[model samples]
Target: MHHAFQIADREINVALSRARTGYRLHLGERIVPVDLRTGADGRAWLTLGDAHIEVVVATRGDDVFVHLDGEAHHLRYRHPLDRLAAAAAGHAEDQIRAPMPGSIVSVAVAPGDAVTQGQVLLVMESMKMETTITAPRDGVIATVNYQPGQTFDRDALLLSLEPMETCA
Candidate 1:
């Protein structure tokens, strides 16, 4: 099984395989574990390479709420496994992805549009919920692949932006 989740504007992918069962994670590095379990109390307990982490996961429609160390966080969705594969496959520097599977509800910019970092680029609808996609850095829109009412898979490239060249 494979999964994807998002944090802020970053995408993370995870791949799980069985027997010798293991889960692989792509988070700036490869993380492999022998076992994983979700507790009845809504916490996920993972044992990987002698490291242990307790994660609390909550899913409401398409929105995910996570709490760790008393800090609450909400994420769209992303697959660390896909991210790892993409990195290994050489897509290291490029536009970011949607991070989760959803329908594009609105596109805020078109090709040739200049945008600043943190600008809202589009809105996506998932499980009846809406999530906004934003620009990660200042750049000009190179392309808009999907539009309003179109559905995309997790990690799907919704748009790409080209960095503005400095004249020096």
Candidate 2:
């Protein structure tokens, strides 16, 4: 099965295949084999590589929440056609927000810096997984809301682009 999930204004594609030993996950060019089992307490055990980690997962509507290590991550399912249509329409989100409670690991841009679409702006870590946040369109950075090591809550505004000017 193939799935797409939206996080931090971008979509990620995942492909899942079952095997006799475990499940194979295709993420872009990387293939990871994992085993998952749920306990009666609702917590799940995930075996990745040689590591066994406990996780909590819940689903609501099109949103899936994953609690790994000590942090939570929310991933929203996106229709593939929706992404194509949005890109074709050239619609871009001006603001980027925290997908879940996490701390900034690094920052690559500051206010007033010019950035292009998909340019890396910052890196954040939640549940020991690092996520890179990127610009959604070509624009100047309008705000720098947090610094490296600063923690943020889910939906917290992390950055914004200067409003595009229009000429009549």
Candidate 3:
């Protein structure tokens, strides 16, 4: 499968093709041979060239956190459909929108609330199913445009987040 991943503020194109030995990893202009094996502890043992490494991976939503060689890296996969929709909407990543026509069942956050990535900010109900809305990244809530029990249309803006400031 071919995928686009945003890692450390850079977009990387990665394509994986099954090979006789294991798999071929295509990264932009470079093609590297790779072999993967699962260890008893559930970690992935990856071999590239003469180097062997063990990596631990955890996933949350569409984001992946990989631990390798005692270092952690965050990877966000941008699916083609999501990229196209973002392009069409011209929306910033900080905006929170309703995924479908739904009534706000609860509001768990308010303006100025500090949120970590993947923290649930609210809950909405559609077709009798409740969906939890989560923070996209670590940030402070900038605004909340809806309240509990309010109805919203699909793609309607529900809230906005401001990036957290960092100390130099």
TM-score of each: 0.49, 0.49, 0.49
The per-residue C-alpha lDDT of model 3 at residue 36 equals 75
Model 1 agreement with the true structure over 70-139: per-residue lDDT tens digits: 6888987544434533532322344667656779888999988888867999998877878776676777
Report the candidate with higher lDDT, 1 versus 2.
2
Better of 1 and 3 by lDDT: 3
**Candidate 2 off by > 4 Å:** 90-168
lDDT of 3 by residue, 1-34 (tens): 6677899888786788888899899987888899
- lDDT for each candidate structure: 0.70, 0.79, 0.79
- Candidate 3: stretches off by over 4 Å: 88-168
Ranking by lDDT: 3, 2, 1
Q: For candidate 2, report its TM-score.
A: 0.49
lDDT value for model 3:
0.79
**Candidate 1: where is the Cα deviation over 4 Å?**
1-92, 166-168
